[model samples]
Target: MELNPWAVAGLVLVALVTYYLGHHSSRSATSTHDFLVARRTVRSRRNAAAISGEYLSAASFLGVAGIVLKDGADATWYPIGFTAGYLALMLFVAAPLRRSGAYTLPDFVEMRLGSLGLRRFATAFAVFIGILYMVPQLQGAGLTLGEIVPGAPAWAGAVVVTVLVGANVMFGGMRAITLVQAFQYWLKLFAIAVPTFVLCMVFFAGGGPAGMRSLGAPAPPVFPKDTTVSVKTNVTVKVNTETYFYAYGEIDDGPARGAAHWSPAVPHKVASGTTLKFAAGTPVPVVSDIPATNDTWLHPASGKITDLLQTYSLIFALFLGTMGLPHVLVRFYTNPDGRSARRTTVHVLLLLGLFYLFPTMLGALARMYVPQLLVTGDTDAAVLMLPSALLPGLPGQLLGAIVAAGAFAAFLSSSSGLLMSVAGVVFTDLLPGRIRDFRVATVLVALCPLALTFLVRTEDLSLSIGITFALAASTFSPLLLLGIWWRKLSWPGAMAGMIAGGGSVLAALIYDTVCGYTGTVPPWWTVQPALISVPAAFLVTYVVSRLTRSGRPELVNDIMLRLHAPDPLGLVQDRVVARFGQVDDKARTGRGRHRKA
Candidate 1:
């Protein structure tokens, strides 16, 4: 079956209605504050939902399942690392950063260090990271639309999302995007949650193909039923336990695509637009890139040194990276105050943890039931295809539709936030800060990613997003953390560190993109740059800040007072939490001096 029309229609309908409502309710943004940070009036719960909506991008929505299906237990660590990054944010940066009262990261930089130069420097990093993140989201949209309407070109879905996102940000700015993103969070949750439940039930009832533990095994999968697999793209696969395979196009070392190709003992190229018919009991072939065995896939990095190094680097990148994401920090600015930001982060942690469980299940399910995807290199389509592969008839179609809708929601919510963030910065810092300038800024910031989506050729959704995180962690994380928590962090040090860290990751991104060096197998030490880049950033910041003090902002004391002090005069503090929980006379002055010591 190629392209489900009903599913496609439902997804487009959902996008149109959500955007219409957001456009309808757009708060006439009259100032830079309104466009950039929603006037800092968002409450905890609502802000939390919007944050989760954007944060759960295509990587979280669909890439997780594909990673799990392809890599097995070790890849489960990816979700843990992602979830932990938010926790690190809650404890280390959320409250104080919100308390800083800046609309954007660059705004915060200027406010903290009293340097227009550093702010502009930060603006550059924000733009780079934002475009990098958005490109993959657009690509994920292409992948999703292709799944919905097979043979659909890559540019179609990207253009659709770009138009919707542009309209929402252009008219309403943060306010409109917030509402749209919040709606998407629930839609995405429902999309995946319902399918996971029904799929689980079916597996238990029908007693799934072989054992469910076959994931990562090199052995070819035994087809449970005579299923006809379609090769949507060209791929090379080596047939395992050869049988009388009836397929179309050039096969057995010939180019992929066409009919009447027999399965040879050796590896052959399967062209696009080809159909491969296999007897239900035929053993499936393993593709070229991924491992062929269950043990390696199931227990990846099983005490191996390289895997361990790669895993730790990934963890560090994610852990520190959350604090630096331009879109994420923008959400904190929407909170009513520091306390509300903290509270919203708690909500985010719980929601993400609960949502990730379903992806793990789906990944395992795909590996067991849809192993043919390994040959086609469409593991990313696992979540989209699992429902129909498990349950047939109307029920499967409906669930499949839900998943497709959710995937589209993922693309919309994430790209919406990132675009708003990058655009807001451009409006405030690059161009004039007039309210109407936001529309122009939105167009300008979007062009890079939109062109990238169409021109550069997108790759794995999760991996590209990961590169951005590594870049952010390397560039801005140390700056944010040090600026907020350290009194001695000078503007010079911050600028130097930002350059050092961001420059390093930027080099890696360029090298990989230009040389085609980044792939399933990459050169040593370059796969995740956080290992070197993050530390280099921190160390540079510390050494420079300690050595040079000329650029320290004179207002550092005043900024610290605001960050650590209770809402002055109760004007900003008048919320549901009436009293200052910890700040009373002595705490207000300074949490009590180190007396006896």
Candidate 2:
């Protein structure tokens, strides 16, 4: 395990700075409003940065590169769809939701439809979605740190992030989080950009290879040096050429001396903890995916029914899912008015779009430079590992450290937002306890996902995060879009749609998660449920609202006016302030002077 002490130190240092900044900013938060929405005083640009910071999770920082590296150009749309989700938010959700002046999604639901039942249902989904989103952050952390230090337990990184994020949230609340998150966003951008710049420079300085851009199928990836590759899990490898295997730490495991098998009907298992040594000229065996040659590394799709369905399903989930995310919506509430909300979203789109460009570059370069990862299924670590592979020595390690810091920043910033959203829902809507309840909620929210990390494998993590998006899109996207635009949506319709849309997707996700563990593969439809589930949620919601006579005309009229009216009109109910003073009422006080004193 070649763990760089500097890289580990860099990760811890960012966590400390984040905690201190959050704590310092939180000192002035004396009320629940301050804690939850920063008193609705966030400016456009800062809030946009914070939103982007949280939105670019480990998936954006690390997973995108790995997916592109493994799957080629067809996987490029993940980042595009991710950035475009903001467009959906700006058009349908941002201004009106901000104008409504609610602190959380459930608050908006209750305010819009006048139903406590629906509020609880929405709150439940918020908690579920927050945790569902958070588990991957933990998984990525473990995978990242594990990649840095090969034998490190996956839980180590998760534990470190949770501790830092929990402290940040427990101390600062939203006011603190806004500053901390915005800072992390720039830090992450620097971390990714600087390394990308340096690596590209190095690639060109080494004299850009003519064969690096080969389009037709070429030879399999060759080891740049005599290397020993470690297998982290039990996987089957397709050996197209002869290779050497060292079994049980000895050079005598094959039939001649090491076991070598031809293409057999039954695939052989390379058990966990096995190590394979290859000479410099050896061809790396392909695993689990179609053979990719140098000539066609940039192919559009894998020509699989599942890949096409998964791509469209992913695009739908990410595009529609952004507006419905609980944490993302809370950032809009922190904006002072509707115009600010729209402006913030526009900035977010620009920032995210700019940051996404380099990951594709990293992925493509990684394919030529570090194809061994494709064999190990640790392509997610390609972003972190690529720098060291290209630069070598201290220069490479330093660049690698920068990437690690950005990766940790991704976990910290995103985890803090998720914790805040979950705790806010727990305190205000679900538990309804005092400020102390936030402390309790923070621990519970962090613990659930940390425990879940043990159950989920690091392989195909983008798919896992996509499944959660499917849940958010299916269940809440319909409710949010309809409640804002459609006047006649009743509380009953909202509840029914949430149940049908969210329920079906949730069931499919559970089946996939569980079945995946038992070596069972669920159908493509079950894995990517957005196309069917999202439409079903919308359909059920519209039909139920039409049949149910639950909405009152006056309440609907009031909510609609507030949502659509300009901020100068002051129609939004956000101005209600709580104040207390000596009443000095003689009848009630009996002694006015004593009451005042």
Candidate 3:
């Protein structure tokens, strides 16, 4: 249980930088306008960096690589969908969303549809989606600190991240965190990119292209050296061939728990708190659901219809979900105008594309170097472990520290944005739109998700985030797309569609999680509900909207004009100012007709 001093130093440095930036930038946040939208003065490039930082949550930083390491080629779709979702946003949603002149997604819903009820409904879902997305970031933090500082409980990391993020948001709000997030983005990029370059150089120098070819070999990956794996959670693994290992825990569902030699001819179950030691050259035992051989893993198609369905469903969710994410959309509101927002999206696309390439490479390398993680089913630690595993000694420890700091940065930046979005919704809709209420909302929103981190068992970080995306895709995707593009969308229709879409995804998530806990295999749709839910949302919204055409807002034409018209035309009004006070006004006395609506 020895702690690495270098890693601790790296984490402390990032925390100091984050706090300094937050405190320095917070001096100007005297009004709700600055706290909520940074007074809409951010330019394209810096805003893009902040958006990229916030968008690249634990799922992107850790989950993508872990999934790729465990699932093979199919995992590539996760990043593709993630990046392409922004493409969808850039093309159809980004400029208009910014032009809508709303501080939050619920604000947009109410501004467009003119229904207080619908705004509250959207607020509820916004909080839900934010919390759902945040759980992964918190869990990833737990996984990371646990790996670096041995014997640290998972909750310790979650608490540390929540405290840092909560303080940043409560004190500085969006204005301060913008600077912090932008800085962290470059730091995260360096953290992942440097290790990838060094490891690739070593791999090529060792075996060149021949080493690359070895990854595709038909045999299962083997332990590069004798390794001891600690299983923190119960998992069932499939042994491809006869293997002997020393184990100290409950095995094969037995009440007797003690040290024993495990030689399994069939699948084996290992209980939590188990420790197993494997000899060098022992074939790795992977979780039962993962591919055991490299050949099968490298291939794109699993030849199963369910696999095909799941892949397409996942793609659909990710492609449409970006626009629906509350944290991502709120960043655009920080842009000065629609044009800046569009440019920011373009820059984000480029930044995200470049960052994603490294994680995929890291995952491929992990298969060769960190096969022991497969047995414990804790591949989420692959990115943090890879540097130390490959380099060894002081160099590896330093690199590991760098990666750990970057991972924490990932959690902090993403959690800050999510908490900001959720707090904004709570402050505006649930509480009075006051400056102090904003601070309270930040505390309230952070606590709910922090508590949730303890109850929900951590799974694949990317997959858990994907479910949140599916919820976003099903609910808000329909609302935003139809509200912006369709002229006849009614408030009742929007509410109904959100319920249909959000309800289905939530049901599937609960059922699937229950199945996982009970050791039962759930159906494919339970895992990826976008294919069934997204269309239902759009269809229900359309049909109900058509049926309730009379309920359409009379101001729909004005809203549409503002959304589509160029910024220079001056059709878009400053709704933030209309609801809260002006950026310069400290009286907090500005409430217009729209606030009442």
Candidate 4:
């Protein structure tokens, strides 16, 4: 792919604008309270925009379309699950969590259960989930930059995003990025919505509704024109029909590999760095996991029993996981009151629903326009490549630039929020809760995930995010749901349930990684464990709480009332102030003594 000056300029423009907005807004963030929760002064609509902006990460921006391109009708569940999760959040968590007067998840854990040990344990999970969530945002950045400027090292974009996001968080914290994120939300919407409208017009003008009907055609997707595909990673592809193509590089590990005609009975392995050129009308050879024909792709639940199981697990993770995301939950703390938090969630649901419509449309369009992506398994690039593929010449490049900018904005906004949440947990739980410690924690949190981006290879962006959601669903979902509603919940039960849930997911992840290295396919449950893990977590929490009923906190009733009562009641005080009052006092005293000297 050739470099597009328009796309590069759009990326640079978005980055500069993000920095300026963050810098301008950060002026008021002089205290720890402002840094952590924006002084809890954000109103409903603006906070809703910021929350929506932060929630629509690279996975939503790029991976949803990519998955749609790969899986056809099956991909619809992702957006449904993602958007509906907010509905669940609004119903169960939004108001109650805001009324809890906790700045972070750990703060809530400690405040409700009155257990320092459980608080520390919850902190560990927060950091872990935050890091897991941040990884794909950085990887998506790399992918976007690479598409804009061909041949650029993937880490370059990751590093650029880390520096910008780290600077924003370290300097201004949540207050600074809140405005930036809100602004980016609209920009992203404009960027994606415009291109989608143009492409849909173009599609209809060329083929009309008859073209739409062809999506369910029995034949496999074919190249619209002569296309060249470069394999960045080794992949095994299944060719459903007899196809002849010109090959330059290793194919199937053959001794003499160049310019070969292929007949397909079994899967064929194409090594990385190989380039294949195919003529127009050639049926695309798709990665083994993808459906080889449009009919199969369009049909939902077309796979075996495992695919059905995986779909349910994916749904469970996404629906329950929203309430548990550390970054997402922290946004509620920025609301002025429980009412504002509830209103913000409603606004978020609407904004998210509007934005998701475009990606689902884009994904469907990609199957018709960008079939070459199937051959290389770079379906994540489907959204980035779609505008140019449908619209030719200058128009295509400009629209491509818009899509690229939106993709980058997705990376920036999401990464900033995740970094803030992780840094807050680190500062409050690990270090002293001083303003200076926030800066240090920001650096530490950003560096750990940035470094990991180098070591770990990028998978399907949405799939990776789904795993984190599963983990969150297993661990914190049970903790929050049980902690808030059940009077009998003990620290031991919360801890035990969290361990059972988190440990199961971790064990599955390890097994999956081992299978990847050994070139074996893991079970469906390992891929999406929420179906097993979520129920296990809830059951364990209930049973263990029953067994340990005698050890329940005496303040459970007060906490419960505080969580459920209306905002005017003021049933609870800010637990963060109570928990860290001594640290704050010591810092103040030290500063005063220094001034005296």
Badly placed stretches (over 4 Å) of model 2 are: 207-217, 239-267, 294-297, 302-306, 551-554, 575-597
Off by over 4 Å in 1: 27-30, 207-218, 227-277, 514-521, 568-597
Per-model TM-score versus the true fold: 0.89, 0.91, 0.95, 0.95
Q: RMSD in Å for candidate 4, one decimal?
A: 4.6
Worst 10 residues of 2 by lDDT: 588-597
Q: Each candidate's lDDT (Cα)?
A: 0.79, 0.80, 0.88, 0.89
Per-residue alpha-carbon lDDT of model 1 for 1-597, expressed as tens digits?
556766887787888877886676474444455566765667777788899999999889888898787777777877898899999899988988887767788988887899998889899889889998899889998988888887788888898899988888888788777778877888888888999998999887865554333544566565666768777666777655545667766565555443343354566677777788776766666666565566666666657677778787888888898889999999998886788899999999988888898988999888888877776777888998888788766777888898999999999999999999999888878775666678899998878888988776555567778888899899889998898889999999998898888888878777767656333445435667788889999999999998888889887888777777765434232111111122123322242111110
RMSD of each predicted structure:
7.1, 5.8, 4.0, 4.6
Sort order, lDDT high to low: 4, 3, 2, 1
- Angstrom error at residue 78, model 1: 1.8
Better of 2 and 3 by TM-score: 3
Question: Any idea what lDDT model 4 has?
Answer: 0.89
Model 3: CA > 4 A from native = 207-213, 255-265, 576-578, 583-597
Which lDDT tens digits does candidate 2 get at residues 427-522? 787555456677787787789989888876666666677887889999889999999999999999999999998988978877877876787767
User: Which sections of candidate 4 miss by over 4 Å?
Assistant: 207-214, 255-257, 578-597
**Which structure among the candidates has the greatest lDDT?**
4
